[model samples]
Target chain A: MPLTPNDVARLADLARIELSDEELAGLTGQLDLILESVQVVASSVPPETTPTSHALSLTNVFRPDEVRPSLPVEDVLAMAPAVEDDRFRVPRILEEAA
Target chain B: MSEPIFASAADLARDLAAGTLSSEEATRACLERIESSDGDVHAFLHVRADEALSDARAIDQRRASGEALGPLAGVPIAVKDAFCTTGSPTTCGSRMLEGWVPPYDATVVRRLKEAGLVILGKTNMDEFAMGSSTENSAFGPTRNPWDLTRIPGGSGGGSAACLAAFEAPLAVGSDTGGSIRQPASVTGTVGVKPTYGGVSRYGLVAMASSLDQPGPCARTVLDAALLHAVMAGHDPSDSTSIDAPVPDVVAAARAGDVAGMRIGVVTELSGEGYAPGVEQRFQEAVAALAAAGAEIVEVSCPHFSLALPAYYLIMPSEVSSNLARFDAMRYGLRVGDDGSHSAEQVMRLSRGAGFGAEVKRRVILGTYALSSGYYDAYYGSAQKARTLIIEDFDRAFATVDVLVSPSTPTTAFPLGERTNDPMAMYQADLCTIPSNMAGNSSASFPAGLAPEDGLPVGFQVMAPPLCDDRLYRVGAALERVLTERWGAPLLDALAGRDRLSEGGRA
Candidate 1:
């Protein structure tokens, strides 16, 4: 199926990255081309082949049940864009009852 | 120009340990070259001249006291920006992490320091290792040292260019898809992508977890192998690290005679899309290898045809998921924070402002592929294709020691030639992606300049997982032939052209 501008917009919303109207218009064409080229994957691969999530087959990896020293708290908070009381500060997530 | 910093890391180390050359002198030589030529090359995103000299002085003192050290001690090297260094900015060439300093060193960085290698600085890369050409770098693009008008190949372009321009003897590059080998191909340097779990990925900025592998870059195959041995080993910090011994790559490089060794030419990676000049160089390399007593055979990896499309889908899907960590609250740029807006709006605005065009394109494509209704069709099929690709490599390796091809379909294209066309940029890694998908050891060694355009061309060799030594053996064999034929290393031919670039600087 050919990609449409509406599809690109929905993708932006899903990815949580806002794209301007002009940017969406531009992405529509590029996405369509990319999708068209990549469609070959669907046709080329056999149905019985299993999906490989990782190149190597690694099983459950567990560590010893002991605490190891980690990054200092001050250093951890130093990288945050906004910090309050040594914790990350963000905009309000909930709204008052309306 | 004062004193060429182009010596191999092994030679530099031999001199440094033998008390013939001081580490301070070598670090100064590399720093001076960087100051003189890096203005136009843009190979370095950050240069720690003082820190590097201090480290070199410390090594010199240790050497003066008769202290034994690693073989590569005191050799100057460039670090790709994808690896975090405590003293230098690990920007990964994006506005998202602009001016952000890492709290600690990447495992590779820590290993290099422990080996007493001088850390010159961080090199430029495609933002978050997204694009093939360094042109995708948000800060700026690194021009090819061969021709400043052309690209240096990329994501690891800065690392390759540093070696090509004689600024650093060795460099560290992380390969996701073909960031390291493709760049090394066009720049006439050697690039190695060790077995996926062979090198620890503890501090490498995640691109694609299953695919990203940090490896060594250098002018000679032995130098790369030397650095490879030093940096590779099991690390308890990273769970995916292979808890086994690293192959004796240095010995393989030293004993680089490939007599009676079978080298297979990958049938699917050539002919149709390869430029005539590039193919000519590849065939010549094969012939030279055969003449050196290596048995040549044709191997068909039919599934390789789908690798690019599959890689496109899979890499972007991983890119989207891994990059979600850079939310506004924790680190990096945050926008639309007037308190009039909510966290959702700030995230949307910040991401839109932070990521570049190619990155945004991949993120959107990934979101679409992983979204509802299309997952089974797109992402699912791509993973299935990945499986087939890996199986294909396994089958081929069962018959031959290693496979060979032109590292890239064509040599370096001009800077803006493929920028508008995303598919074209993706094709830059066409010949190199299979190894990444299969988690094999792959590398590109300088084959000679293309006769028509006088640009460097690379011959790629790949070995099955953990047998990285074969890559070095094959590469060193071919490098020996090509060097003997040209009467010097391929970079020797670039000296005159580099001087030309230097002349145009002022």
Candidate 2:
């Protein structure tokens, strides 16, 4: 399916990125070209083949249930763009229960 | 001791041990060279001169006190900006984390420090390692040392450029696709991408978790092997790290013998699209190996033709998911944070502001692929294709101990030549992506300069997982033959050019 600029705008929204009108138009064309090339995989892959999400045959890895030293709280908070009382400060999420 | 700046990492280590050269002197030489030439090359994103000098002085003191040190001790090395180092900015070449200093060191960084290697600061890379050339770096493109007008292969271009420019003898690079080897190919250096799970990814900023492998970059295969040994081994911090002992690559590199080894040349990875000079150098290197008593055969892996298409889908899907953490809350650049905007608005605006064009492109592509309607067609089929590609490697490895190809189809292209054309830029990794898909070890060793452009060309060697030693054996063997044929290492020609240019300036 040919991707329209609206489709790219929707994807950008899903990705939590606000795209300008110029970027949306440019990305739509570029992504259409990229998708056109990569879409070959859909037709080429045989149905019986099992998908390999990871390279290694991995099992769940666990460690001893003991506490280990972690990074200092102050140091961690210092990296935050906005720090509150010992925690990350952020813009409010809840719209006042109207 | 014999122009410390251009000496191999192994020779510098030997000199440092023999009391003929102080770590400080060697470190200063590299710093001075970086100071003099980096204006044009722009290889380093950061150069920690004070800290590197202090670390070198400490190593010199430890040696003076008669303490034994490891082989790479006191050697100055460059780290790719993607790795986190405490007390230094770890930008990963993005404005999002422009000046964000990591709270702690990555496992690789800790290991390099523990091995007593001095850190010479972080080198530039594609922002979040998304592009084929260092042109994606938010800072600017890193110019190739051989020809300043051309690109150094990337996203490890800065690391490779530093080695080619004689700024650092050893550097670390991470490869997801061809970031390390492709850059090494164009720069006349050696780069290794150890098997997935062979090296810990604890603090190397996540790209595609399944594909990323941090390895070594150096002027010689043996030097790469030495750094590889220091960096590889199981780290409990990264659950995917291989638990088995690291391959004895150092011994294999020193052996430098390919006698009786079965080397396969993949039929699909060559011809058409490949530059004639690149093909010529690769064919010559293969012939040299055959003359060295290796049994060579042509192997067919038809699925490899689909590697690029599959990688484009799979890598972006993972990229979209992995990059979600850059939301404006915890760290990095936060935009639209005045009291008016909501949290969601802040996230959208900040991400829109922080990321560059290529990063945005990949992230959006990944989002579309992973979205509801197209998930199975794009991401699922790509995963299935990944299986087929892995099976191709398994079948090829079943018959031969290793496989060979040109590291990239062409040599260093002129800077800005492919920046506007994403497809052209993506073509750089065509020959190197299959190994990443299958999670095998692969490397690029300097074959020689291309006849037409006189830029370096890389010969790639692929080995099965945990058999990384085989890569060194093949690379060392080829390096020996090529060095003999060229009458010196390929970079000596580049160095000769630098000398002539300097003399002309005088």
Candidate whose TM-score is highest: 2
In terms of lDDT, the best-performing candidate is 2
lDDT tens digits by residue: candidate 2, A1-98: 78999888889999999899999999999999999999789998998899999999999999989988998999998889899889999998976454
> What is the per-residue lDDT of model 1 for residues B324-413, given as tens digits with 9 covering 90 to 100?
887787888988888877888889999999989888998888888888888999999999999999999999989999999999999999
Question: Which candidate leads in DockQ?
Answer: 2
Task: Single out the weakest 10-residue window by summed lDDT for candidate 1 chain B.
Answer: B497-506
lDDT of 2 by residue, B1-506 (tens): 27999799999999999999999999999999999889888899999999999999999999999999999999999999999999899999999999999999999999999999999989999999988889999999898888888899999999999999899999999999999999999999999999999999999999998899999999999999999999999999998999999999999999999999999999998889999999999999999999998999999999998899999998999999999999989999999889888899999999999999999999999998899988999999999999999999999999999999999999999999999999999999999999999999999999988999788899999999999999999999999998899889988876765732342121
Q: Residue A22 lDDT in model 2?
A: 97
Q: Could you tell me the lDDT of residue B412 within candidate 1? A: 90
TM-score of chain B of each: 0.98, 0.98
* TM-scores for the candidates: 0.98, 0.98
Q: What's the lDDT for residue B38 in model 2?
A: 90
Kindly report which residue pairs in candidate 2 clash with one another: none
